[model samples]
Target chain A: MNINRNNYEAYFISYIENELNNTQRKAVEDFVAMNPDLKNELELFGATKLEADEKIIFADKESLLQKNSTKIIAWKWNINVWASAAILLLLLGVGWWMMNQSAVKSHQFSEEKINVKSDSVKSSELRIRNSELIKTEKHYLAKNNFAKTKRVENKNFNAKIILPETIDTAELPNSWTSRKKWNEEHEIHVVQEIKPEEILQVQKNVAEIDTIKAVAQNAISVPPTKKTEEKMIAQIPFKTSKNERQILKMLAWASSKVLGKETNNGNFDVSIGFAEISHKQALQDN
Target chain B: MTINDYNFCVTAYADHLFRFIFKHTQHEENARDVVQNAFEILWKKRDEVEMEKAKSFLFSVAYKNKIDQFRKQSKVNLVDEFSAQTKIINEHKSGLKDALEKALNTLPDIQKSCVLLRDYEGYDYKEIGEILNLNESQVKVYIFRARQSLKNYLVSIETVL
Candidate 1:
């Protein structure tokens, strides 16, 4: 555009604003020179252009700097999580089954370590007075006293007096002959009040029971202490079912046969009134 | 924009933003607040802003914040201007620099922001227009009127001297 009396001021602003080229700037200078009366106003206009203030800076740019390295993560859901859970559960189940299998194998290799601590008396007896058990087993399985042992196959049979080889419970009959079957038969809950030592002693002497009817019959001839026996019978615990009573009595008599000293003395009161069933009587008689 | 781009805006434009806001607010804390507010808004909307527009966005926000601040405290502004002039008259023996500064303060806020953004940032008229939400011609007019006002202020001071 042309600089004129009317438009010269716009030219002047552009000139001072450094918006003008050299030709336009020179034209503005020439026009201003031609107008000396407007010179002071032009100088004031030039002076209005403010200088940059270098000193006023933002003091703490540090506060604006974010230190968190948080990534902008768009939420992505895993639809396969159920599959992963199922796989994890499968692994856990397999681990549990393996552990259970190993536990059974270890069970078969194990047996109770029988302790044979004797009571004050040399001949220790463990008998149950549960007459009900006696009647049932005596009628049915009692004839097998000679076979009083489906468990004769157990290594514990030939075991010596002290610290015998453990009898493998697996070899025992499926009947309540094994202690495990004893436990499994939930029908009975006989808490043995006898020192477990007395039971262990009976267990020890049980090995001496000769599977001969001749020796067993001789034991029956050893005169019975009917008076002492009656007193001991009063001490018996609850009357058991026939099978459990028969088992307890058989164990007691096997122990008695080996402790011949106490029996010969006739001092064997067997006062604790436990049992000696037809199984052992049959074994001793055999 | 990325975080690095945002931080670059901070390093590059913080001083200019501060100086521009400071000229209008005339108080360091108030200017810093305006400047900080601008940067905070920029950071919050970082994803929406472009790197090329960061400086313009910051100055635009700062200018609006300063105007808002002024509007909020407008009741006291006249009293402040009167006191400023009184202080200027009392300190009349100071140089043209002080006179020019006082005179700059005397101009309306729009002229002050326009002229200062022009000088301090060396922004072209379109750039200033973009920051102030004015057209290029409006920016030019505001700058011209601001210069005329400043020149008149200088003339008054010269006659007094």
Candidate 2:
């Protein structure tokens, strides 16, 4: 209660910091409560102390705050970006599933078909004709029971027959309907021409006709025309079983369908005949 | 806390927090920066920050930011120089503003900060300790030292005049 400026420094410092024990604090509080002059001195000291603790404001503060603010903003931006990425992934998954469903539906609706070209059908037809020719030659020789005669031709002989350059394209009645029909049924491949032995035997038959003419049995008789000879040769039987004939017709129909065209055209004549390859063997073996 | 709560905290505490930072760093711009950053951090963590602890939390952030700034500068002499200029101003008072300003600057950075929180912001020693990352005893010592320093400067003025 009777405190003076001389001792105030030590006591004031301890008092403000609450360093005083309970009794000391109580004494100071009671003294201030009773004495206005003492209280006023304390208040002045407190005000002056506050004034003395002033701070100077410097210019660098703004830049520091700006740097700190920038850091805080960057952290916020990262959070937003992560959220956006998660949303994007979810959308992509949905879109992918939708596309897969449509693709599967389209695949189910489609059909697979193979188209055979027209050229292949034509080639198969040619093959059938050749096989028929070989079969006819075999049958003819077997039916006659002819001796397997070999006519040895003299290559040096001047009597070699010359074939005609061209044949007339005459429309013949379809005498070979069954042959044509048989050919239409099968997938055909052309066989090679008859052997030299067959050609020699034909030449021998011609020589015999010449000899008979020289003996004067028929003075007016003429050499057979190439067309007539070809017709006679084609008359040889190419016997096919009923089942074989049916299969050949089906193959021909299939081939025609592949070409997208009809096989039997009245304008087109098939006159090429079958030639035996081994007449001597056929005649002897039969 | 919502946006409104965040704004309220900022409006209530920004200037006081800036003053504390300014007292320590002696730079108004750096003080503003430290306070703003502290508020921004609070805003970002609004949900986690409690209203009762908001003041201390903000001061704690600002205090740490100031320390980091000083450390980055990498020269103890700079801090000492700042302290010396502050001491000189406190001793020589040309005007009331000059005297008060210098008096505030005279305290060491930690003491200055403690005094600001105590007198200007009206925070207790426990709150000061939490903000400055000091123990309660350390906070008490800082505030005590700061007040003593200010009293001596004011007494010197009275004696000289």
Candidate 3:
């Protein structure tokens, strides 16, 4: 369209709306440049268009959706927090249980050590008693002249007896001759002189023997023949007879005397044998 | 699009659609309902809607719902008329911007919608035509008439001031 004064308003409005074609836009621009008075009107129209746009703003969606959006966020946050707390609690429980188990194990270990030490001490005392009993048995065999006589009477008797070779018999004091004389004179006296403590020690030895028998029975894979059991019993010459009882009492008294001297001021001199007469008297008392 | 893409669309275009509807309806509740309904429709057809076309789809749905709202009311909304009257009464006290707003209210609903789509959203005439269910030329005519009304209001205000 031609941009004359009458048509300029339509072209200027179209130009402001960006509706004018290039030729129409040029025509409008030329007319506006020539008439500077129309420029202020165009500026006012542009400002009004901008202001009208500013007036019709949409409500902020972030503010509008704040309640729902925050709720969703809080729900997710709560799940995360709870999950973390649960894992932490589980770890703490596992740690506490492991610590308690270790403490119990250590306590048990210490108790085992104390029991082992006491067992070793008991075993040592039993060794000393065993050595004394073997010595007493040898003396009874010699005095009664049974070692040679029993071999002929019991044809199944084995001459070889298995003794712990660890104990040196030569280290024992030569009080066996006087012990025989004391026995001949006071065989009954020895049984009467046996102390209660010695009797308790004998009972402990009996219990230990029973335990060993039980362990052996559990360890054996096969049952022994009746003949083998009989042979095993016949090999041991020590029977539960009156003479064997007297022998046990005499051995107990001798062990007590030896242990008493050793315990007193810790003196363990084995050669003195106290006095041969006092030994004879102890045998008489036995 | 996936549900994720639909959710993205809601966050991205919800405010823009709401603004367009709110400007057309001049009622906050109606605009919110229209935007929400538009999103619901988008979600229902999410499998068919593409991510790039989501903005156009949302605006189209919101615009249709806004038109339906205007049809449902049938009677002219006195709120807009009252606001325009108050704006004109206070025209001398306000700037050319206030006068232009009053003039915008004076235009036909279709013209006002087309002009706003053109000026405010910076949509081309063809795009505005698509949104308002008009041809490109028709969109151009609505915008030109709307701007002419605005310019006249500004001049009258300036002469009064």
DockQ of each: 0.25, 0.08, 0.13
Q: Which candidate tops lDDT?
A: 1
List the lowest-lDDT window of 10 residues for candidate 3 chain A: A119-128
lDDT of 3 by residue, A1-286 (tens): 6677786766777777777789888888888899999898777667546433333334444432323356788999999999999999999888766555543443344335434532211000111122222222211121111221121222121121111112122322224333333333322123434455554565354334343233322322123334433333343333444434533443333334433433243222221221221233223334
Q: By DockQ, highest first, what's the ranking? A: 1, 3, 2
Off by over 4 Å in 1: A1-7, A71-286, B72-93
- The CA lDDT of each predicted structure is 0.55, 0.45, 0.51
Among all windows of ten consecutive residues in candidate 2 chain A, which has the lowest summed lDDT? A118-127
Per-residue accuracy of model 1 over B56-161 as CA lDDT, tens digit each:
9999987765666664553343423423212222234366677788888888888888999888888899999998999999999999888878888999988989
lDDT of 2 at A117: 20
Interface RMSD of 2: 7.3
Ranking by TM-score: 1, 3, 2
Per-residue lDDT of B59 in model 2: 83
Indicate the docking level reached by candidate 1: acceptable
- What would the TM-scores of all predictions be? 0.48, 0.42, 0.43
What value does DockQ give for candidate 1? 0.25
Candidate 2 error regions (>4 Å): A1-10, A17-26, A29-45, A51-286, B68-97
- Residue B6 deviation, candidate 3, in Å? 2.2
Candidate 1 chain A, run of 10 with poorest lDDT = A138-147
